[model samples]
Target: MVRGAPSGDLSGKTVLVVGANVGIGLEASKHFARMQPARLIIACRSEAKGKVALAEIERETGYNGCEPWIVDLANFASVIAFADKFKREGGDLHILVMNAAIALPVYQPTIDGWETILQVNYLATSLLSLLLIPQLVAAGRKSTVPSRMVIVSSGVLYWLTPAKEIETSLKPLETLGSEEWCIPNHMQSRYSESKLLNLFFVRALTDRLRSVTPLSTIAVTPGFCYSQLRRVWYEKPTFSFVKIVLAIHERLLAWTAEQGSRQLIFAAVGGRDDEENMKGGFVSRGRLVEVADFVLSDEGHRMQDTVWNETIDILSGVSDKISPIVRDYLVVPDSSIN
Candidate 1:
């Protein structure tokens, strides 16, 4: 069981939880709403589903500050539009949670031509984070309280293939939007790889923000939780046996969504006294833990640097208005890039 709740009051602050329609995101949204934020935005791809979630959260928590916003991570254009709209009209964002993620039982490519898991979980996620840095920074400057950007990473990242191996297999930077590199049989591996990328992104972004911004960027894993994340795998025809095994495991071992979301809540709002130490660190089960050795190795650092540069290059092409600081952060010694 998780050990803490958000220690701070959210009065007058604006919080946004992306992909909050179901699972851990939904539960986390409800948790945040109860803290009495000035405004709570529940962002999802489906406005209909998002509205339903918005209503449910308000009904259950009696926190009427919640509203729904549309953001389809599978579509890069949608991500761009959402960010642009938020920048233009959304008020200062004190807390931003990148909690939405997808896991596919079968490989599929998004309209953007990148694999679905990669697009929704990593690429578009990186795009939105870069686009919103200016707002987070602005909000951080004005608020007496620390502003935060939380990335919902997973501990399963440790089980993924080595960074160098996965990088060589995908050569993602070179094959940005191409389907030729994605294999149908590799869907599960791809999902794990995406989560690993989340860790890398958190580390890279935290390094960039250290000297320039007060915004706290951190990553946390909710541990193994029973959530809708695995529904697709269970529903698919090819996985009936796998579904049975998962059902049994969930019944006996997995934490309920609400139980699991505590980690998210804690990571988002707890440990305020040590927020600086939490930056770029990985939290699991409500405690900051050491990262896997592979993630700290020399090769691992190279992998993170490569992913950071490639991500910036991709998002820069999509939106020419990226913040100057974000662009400059991607600038590393030429040796680092190679």
Candidate 2:
């Protein structure tokens, strides 16, 4: 049942998809182009690669409304600049897809001083999302339909628990991203933990925004798909036998990248009649699904707030402007959850 989104017109909406040059990001961008949004911003890591994606989309869909922008998730400065640029140039944001992520075989700290996976997947992602919330709120309030924010996560999260070291730390996200706290044996789980953080963030954001405006923020898992996301397994040195096993295993079970992208499209604009089901929901292969048992657990709820507060504290420090935006737009976190 892997397919593009069902017939839907994106005529008035403005859409942005990050990490759109390859893998699911690329495929989703292509599909979005066909829907013909008012504007389609393809945010990539570099200008050259982004232009290539833009060209391909235009050629494939004959959609002239697409533009390419560069934003590096590892660089907070870059993310801030892109947000400022988008706001100055546009009125209200409609569809925002936070689609960029990384899976590294080892812990490598970025120049920004956060471990690569945590920064790209969570911290910087949160930074960008926070900066854009006001615009989302504005668009949502004016329109009868809810604006959409899709946080791409993975189902692999069901198989992970916070490493004891990360769990014991007072700051779970900070510890998970800190080189000093990295457990030698825990490197393999970093990617999975990052996805868990996404789900936590979606729940936190959705709960806080319920009364604020017409916005639906949903977390989605594209399911295991054949993607360049696992390039690290091929690029970095490992036992040849191990590489063979990983490759074959994925080849046998994975969906095509295009197949995975459909779920993203479905999340972005699907469920118009049942928008309530999508608010704070998770979807797989275009169907609404419950989060894992742990995500619905009492402890999981508490941990999500911890992650949200720490995220706000860290991101608020990045720019003084963030404080006013959060205060003016987003409602205060529900005390019941705290």
Candidate 3:
């Protein structure tokens, strides 16, 4: 089991967890409540599930700061509405955890044109992060404690290989999102690709925030936890035999939900003194670790830049609600791109 307790206090802070209904997310929410935050907002796709989680958190932790808010990551509009409501009613946002993600064995497109995994895990996650930046900046400026954005990524990203299609183009992001690249046969790769993008986004955003905001952005791997995310494979008919094997493996090797959540809790509250160094860094097993060698290569640097620019461009087209400061930070100058 993972070990370590959350350091410092969150007595009057406001915390938000995007996927708080199950697994590590639910466990993390309970941990946050125990820290005595002023408010703990549980944001998830289903109101019913969120209510159940809210009650469970309160009952387990005996902390009443927990509340449920519905936010669907598959729909950009839903993300916008959730952000808008929080801006209107929420207090200073101290901790923002982007932990909601979906991995599917079958190919499915979201209401947005992108594949389901891509939409929920990367695009919509980006939208919510961008929309909420102003509030994070404000909170950072006024609070003595540093505000943070913890992105839950996966160690699976280490397995990603450069796609042949990506290598053939000067602009890789255009082809990377194509349907041929995101179908079922390639679903595992697609999920790994999304986690890679999460790392890229964290690095880029951390650089942007360093000068203008006190918000520290970092990526973390929970080290192979047992979670509902495995349902994608277990629920498939063709994978029944594989499922049984995996179940046994998980029982033997995977961290419990509570154990898995300790990493995220540590990232949120334990490493305050190292916030500057932690910015844009990756954490695994409670220690800062180097990203994959490919991610540090010249080609990888170019892809990261391309992905960041493409993400901002796509999000800008979808929502005109972005504040000017956020727009300024995200928009790549025409000269720089050219």
Candidate 4:
């Protein structure tokens, strides 16, 4: 089991955990409630699921202050509406845990005209994280302390390599979302590739946060827990072989959801240096670790810039607030100046 998180009193802090309706997200939200936050917002896609999560946290932790809010990562409009609602009425937020993600074995498109996994796991997640920066900054300034954005990534990123099609394409995001790349062969690695993009976003965002001292972000891997991430594989008959292999792997190495949530708790409410080191760092198990070896290669650096640029350009089209958020709150890397 992972060690416990360093104790911190969150009597006046506002903690929001997106995708907290189940699994690691639900476990993490329950842990945060024990810290006695001023307001613990449980962000979920469905109102019923959110209410159930809130009730569970209250019953388990005896913290009745948790609020259920619908924040659907599959829809860009829903994400933007939540962020805007918070901006208008919500107070400063201290810890934002972005733990919502999906794993689909087929090419499923959201109503927004993008692949389901691509939008939920990358594009919409990126939009919400960037959009909420101003609120995070306000909380940090108010307390004269730092705020954290703990984005749940995965260790599987290190095992996968980007397709030649993606690596060679000038427009990586477009190429990724193209129907040509969503075939069976490519779908096998869709979730892994999305995790890779998460790291790249962290790398780029960490660089941008250099200009904003009040906020720090880190991407964390829960290290293969028994979670609902593989629900698609179970529900889809075509993935039977894949499911058998995963069940074996999971029974052999997967941690309990509570055990995995420990890493997120530590990242969200760890010691001073722990939080300070969150500047785009990667966490796995219970400690900070280096990113993938591929991520350190020259090709990796170039690809990081490409993913960052493509994502930002797309998000700028999604919401006009993105470009200004980059300009006013973040410093663009020198390589992206053009």
lDDT of prediction 2: 0.86
Q: Relative to the true structure, how large is the alpha-carbon lDDT of every model?
A: 0.81, 0.86, 0.81, 0.86
Residues forming the 10-long window of minimal summed lDDT in candidate 4: 329-338
Model 3 Cα displacement at 38 (Å)?
A: 0.5
Give a tens-digit lDDT track for model 4, residues 219-251: 899888999988777776574777899899899
Q: How does each model score on TM-score?
A: 0.92, 0.95, 0.93, 0.95
- Which pairs of residues collide in model 2? none
Error of 1 at 63 (Å): 0.9
- Per-residue lDDT tens digits of candidate 1, residues 67-86? 89999999989998998889
Regions of candidate 4 where Cα sits further than 4 Å from its true position: 237-239, 274-276, 334-338
Q: Global lDDT for candidate 4? A: 0.86
For candidate 2, the C-alpha RMSD (Å) to the true structure equals 1.7
